[model samples]
Target: MKTFLLRKVHITVCGRFKLNDMHILVNTRLLLPGRFTGVEWFTFETLRRLVKWHPDVKFSFLFDRPYHQDFVFGDNVQPIVAHPQSRHPFLWYLWFEYSVPKVIEATKPDLFLSPDGFLSLKATIPQISVIHDLNFVHQPEGLPWLTGWYYRYFFEKFAEKATRIATVSHYSANDIATTYNFDTNRIDVIGNGVGDDFFPTKEIPDLLELDSKPYFLFVGSLNPRKNILGMLKSFELFKLKYNLPHKLVIVGDPMFKLSEMQSFYSAMQFKSDVIFAGRREGSDLNKLYAHATALWFVSFFEGFGIPIIEAFRAGCPVLTSTTTSMPEVAGNAAILQEPENIEGIARDMYNLATDTLLVDQLKSKGTLRAQYYTWDKAAERLWDCINKSL
Candidate 1:
């Protein structure tokens, strides 16, 4: 691996240097082994395509810890493991502010790409950072004090520091620009995509041990912004109103505010009906989506609702919030409801449970809508953003 040390004269404007000479430094810390979330999937799916499509371009993926070779998509790609696993707010600062700059100084790549939104404030190179959402901005109580403070303090700086911005949706882009007073034109919207693993299944997989009773599904971290309490209240209302045996199956680990989730769960009248299945992914997650009565993802805010598309691809009808990017991603394919309207959510849940025709219609529309977003398109848009930054 040859290292290029020349500063600003690496490429000419009118006739650029050979494409083979281009080198891109990437923040790949989110690509954790066996822990695939929305941001992780976005990073992996788009990067794999970018590396494959541009075989001559060298991409140096910087990881904070030991990386899985599955993330290294091509021979043109180089994986560099940096120090200090950035799990906490303090470590996050050290890794991005100090360690990442050290790597940048050493490599001297033409550009730096940060998919997880964090940026190196010390770097002089043109950088692109993907600001996923302003969840912490809207609802600071949703996160821990230190974590929320870190975001509030540094994210604004990151927005100002980036040469170009990429986000999962237009709602996020607009929010970033408005909140941070940054230029909207500099931001690119790269929507989320569903992998081929998620699809409509004729029969539920044997791994999921559910009874004959149909269930409503909720997929995401058990955080306050997800409106876990609201969903629980809505489920209680639905159970109280109807004599049906429909269950509310929550599939995700308790990421934050676990005590609140526990308190709500303990106080429920139909607590036995709510199943807490911690974190399902890949084909197992697909099985849950395909067999669910409907996906209830009425969150307070979201940059992009990945599960809504996942459910759509799995032939599951959706009932999501009208706020932020949920409506943008869902289009006319889902039943939209206000995040705080527990009655409305319950009513929609009841409607889905009883109305077979409505469910079928949503399933058809959702599958069609899911076709619009794909990793290939996302990768192309991200690559375009990289090119524009350069």
Candidate 2:
């Protein structure tokens, strides 16, 4: 009797959505300022387009903390600022359980979307959660204890609760299905898109460090999973032996277990050749991408490497990891390197800088591949998923 009733409810919910008349409440906490990482950017890019594309359908953006003005993408979109930023574990539980659920109930949204892979168990509405990567499950020790615990426990329940699952890559889709024991059919593979800002532009005055020196660019948060140490070691090896007048430019904010990495960094033989550009965005990031030797991003794991496509858009070659979703993203376009193998990474970096024919070939392939992925295409696909779920 319970099973039969559940089936009826499911059919009733998924059977119909008057697209023009529907309302959606999005968890826009990730869209706030000082957090334009891959996950946040994905949500912002998709929603900005979605709101404009569907004028009749109202989109309510729910932020857990004080909202930003730039997040208001359209007049058709409504903004709801709730309480508790939920930077900590207990706050996270409270926000999802009490605050967000209450807001949903009051809003009476036809559907709910959470791009951060968090779904409110209290909300009865159909929900779409974007599970970028299951790194917490795969690399538990990389994260703090409470964070890892929350992710492992709540995410399993959220996966079950989510009306539909959207993953960035087929690799991640498979992982989610196998790890969570979720239905594969329920997962939708919507790949991330390259932003418009990453075009072939002239270098700005911000980075005078790369004035005359050939350089290899590494763009990712300075963390263990990002293999920053590995990259540094590889760069050290390349400069020591090759004696190329090339610098290593690292662009990202320091995140997680950095003391040891910092200590190691200070002891580098070629530390002077490595320049940390810090976290960059907008025009500065585009300039960095535009005028780079090549992107060196051999992460240990990823749902999707957005920078691979960003480099593609910038008309720059990429040396990404052979493992995870990178091989899928590159698609014979960029050079693939083993993340853990520092020697291999160094060899590839050297090859990218020295070999003209190889670099040109990669650039050509990368530009062509970049065309296939754009914000418009991503928005359309995401909207289709949203429309169908409605």
Candidate 3:
């Protein structure tokens, strides 16, 4: 958001990549400071490495609002704060279609990279879109009507027009390819990653603050597609049948269509046992994962479940959905279950709570699986995608 001027540097040769002459105009609208969601995390973690790795390649980061200096990442990154802040569906259209194009004209980079998948349809330059998933397409009820409509209408066009596409998992890659009928060869599979901070704890933190009770952790927005209702119901069932001391700890702030979840929570007999530790991060969030009984992320759909790997990195066992990208990300490390199977989820919860050997095995597998993903590797793959487009 700082007012810094950039001189347009043109490449004299076109055949091969010249690091000094390359300028990539990135749609960094999702890089909101302090509010790192899945997309924002992806953008921040990867872009941080990208700029550092290719110091000679200029990266023009287009932001709708003023960005934090920390996000500047390196001297190579030029942060340009453009017009109206894009938060709503209408504003999103205005920012991407109108505001971004003007910035594109000014920067005139060789290629454009859109991490959150919103591309400038008006821009003539080669564009690469990282379409994480088609979650909105599969479950429209999870989003606001206008937001859903915008994604359904414009994303296909974005995919078709993009010079290259990048997605998190093979499942998501396949979903994007089949949904848009896009060529698989042009798509790059770049998965989400875990930070070093989320490692296994040497000893469990003091449980006095949490009533000294072991708890199942649920992380992610309390959106309908995340199946907040389903998770609550399953936890209620587990409490009812077992009457155990274990509690269900819910993390993350409530997002979109939570009236039903509220209604269900009111009717539950063991509602008091469920703790809503909203929007936790840093060392506290790391401790929550490390000391939890297991991570219960049974979301109905996902492009890729980031918490699965985060939990894996923290040496926490996982119970996630079998559908979509969960199995692909979890592999054999997590206890996969159908998101709709309330009874089955309850059973798995019981298993994790009681079985010691299973926990140890899952922890070992999760640690091993966690090694496959890292921000460094993800950034490298994304850079490769950018290289291909150029």
Q: Tell me the number of clashing residue pairs for each predicted model.
A: 0, 0, 0
CA lDDT of each prediction against the hidden true structure:
0.88, 0.83, 0.87
Tens digits of per-residue lDDT, candidate 3, 240-354, equal: 8877888888889888889989999999999888888888876778898999999999999999999999999998999999899999999999999999999999999999999
Worst 10 residues of 1 by lDDT: 8-17
Of 2 and 3, which scores higher on lDDT? 3
Q: Which pairs clash (backbone N, Cα, C closer than 3 Å) in model 1?
A: none
- Candidate 1: TM-score? 0.94
* TM-score for each candidate, following the candidate numbering: 0.94, 0.93, 0.94
**Candidate 1 per-residue lDDT over residues 1-390, each given as its tens digit:** 332323321211111223467899999988987687889999999999999999999888888776777888888788777767889999898888777887777767999999999999989999999989999899898899999999999999998899999999989999999999999899999888989989988767443436767899999988889999999999999999987899888888788776877888898889988888888888888988999999999999899989999999999999999999999999999999999898999999999999999999999999999999999999999999999999
**Global fold similarity of model 3 (TM-score):** 0.94
Candidate 2 stretches with Cα past 4 Å from truth are 1-20
Candidate 3, overall lDDT? 0.87
lDDT (Cα, tens digit) per residue for candidate 2, span 1-390: 011122111101111224457899888887768768899889989989998888888777877665777887876677776666778889888778777777776658999988888888988889998999999998776788889999999999999998889888899999999999999988888889977788888765277777677788888888788888888889999988888989988988887877777887899998988899888887788877777889999989888989999999988889999988999988999988888898888889889888999989998999999987777887887887787677
Please name the candidate that would achieve the greatest lDDT relative to the true structure: 1
Clash total of candidate 1: 0
* Pairs in steric clash, model 3: none
Name the lDDT of candidate 2: 0.83
